[model samples]
Target: MKKMLIVFLIFAFSLSAKEVPSSGEMMFDLIPIRPLGLAALAIGSGFFVLSIPIGLLSADPRQTLEQSARRLVIYPLHFTFQRPVGEFYGYMEEIEYVSD
Candidate 1:
């Protein structure tokens, strides 16, 4: 019991003796103006507010793809197509396919 107490005291004293800076030394001498940080926060908040209406106004993927193809392309990509036989599942699972 005494041996354990002596070991604990020695360990505690050794830890406390390590060089720890005073609060004055650890504190920043010059604080940042942070204009950029404030600007970023403002812009992010604006975008968050903007996204709520934009998301509601956004068209469905199938309709958007169809419209884009009709307005500006030789062929339009369709999202409602099925997979070709013997193709790997992972290879084409997430791609938008166009009928040629």
Candidate 2:
């Protein structure tokens, strides 16, 4: 019983001593901002829009273009959609599994 009490006191003291990373400091961590990814996403969307004109003008691989469009849209969307819930895949904040 004494050992358990001592352990509890030590644990409490350690928790008090530990400083949490500020939410602001970890803001980008949750959403991993990538300018390049955003740029590519924009370019892909632009090209997909341009392809619409080409498709209207002549023969075009509609199926292939659809696949490419999906790929392009999905990559950056992945960052937006996947980065938040790092532990679970969709929720906002990361839940700590192990506490100090």
Candidate 3:
């Protein structure tokens, strides 16, 4: 009975074992980005940044206000107030403008 039980357990463990497929058999393929691809990405990012101000200027006042509010919330503690030229001390300032 002990030998039979050990054989059964071995068979059960073997049945539960899973076989992984080779890398070539993977469903998704990863492609490396070339230098040209990176350059294109940089150019696209620059264009996106340049377009924001143009869009803001062309957009309505309400949209601009909403955008400004969103920016303030995203960068809550960004700006600091420094003495311009002849002041003795520097101070940290909350640079956000909240609207009603």
Which residues of candidate 1, in runs, are more than 4 Å off? 9-33, 55-100
Q: What's the TM for model 2?
A: 0.39
lDDT of 2 by residue, 1-100 (tens): 9999999999888843544556764455455555555776788788777776665655556755655566667555555444433222233234222323
Clash tally for model 3: 0
C-alpha lDDT of candidate 3 relative to the true structure: 0.44
Q: Write the per-residue lDDT of candidate 1 for residues 1-100, one digit (tens) a residue.
A: 9999999999888854545545443232112213333444455555545555544566675555444443233111111123222222352345554655
Root-mean-square deviation (CA) per prediction:
22.1, 11.2, 20.2
What is the Å distance of residue 1 in model 1 from its true position? Answer: 3.0
Alpha-carbon RMSD, candidate 2: 11.2
What is the descending TM-score order? 2, 1, 3
What TM-score do all the candidates reach, one by one?
A: 0.31, 0.39, 0.25
**Candidate 1: clashing residue pairs, number:** 0
What shift in Å separates residue 10 of candidate 1 from its native position after superposition? 5.7
Candidates 2 and 3, the one with greater TM-score: 2
Pick the winner on TM-score between candidates 1 and 3.
1
Q: Which consecutive 10 residues in model 1 have the weakest lDDT in total?
A: 74-83
User: Candidate 2: minimum summed lDDT over ten consecutive residues — where?
Assistant: 91-100
**Top candidate when judged by TM-score against the true structure:** 2
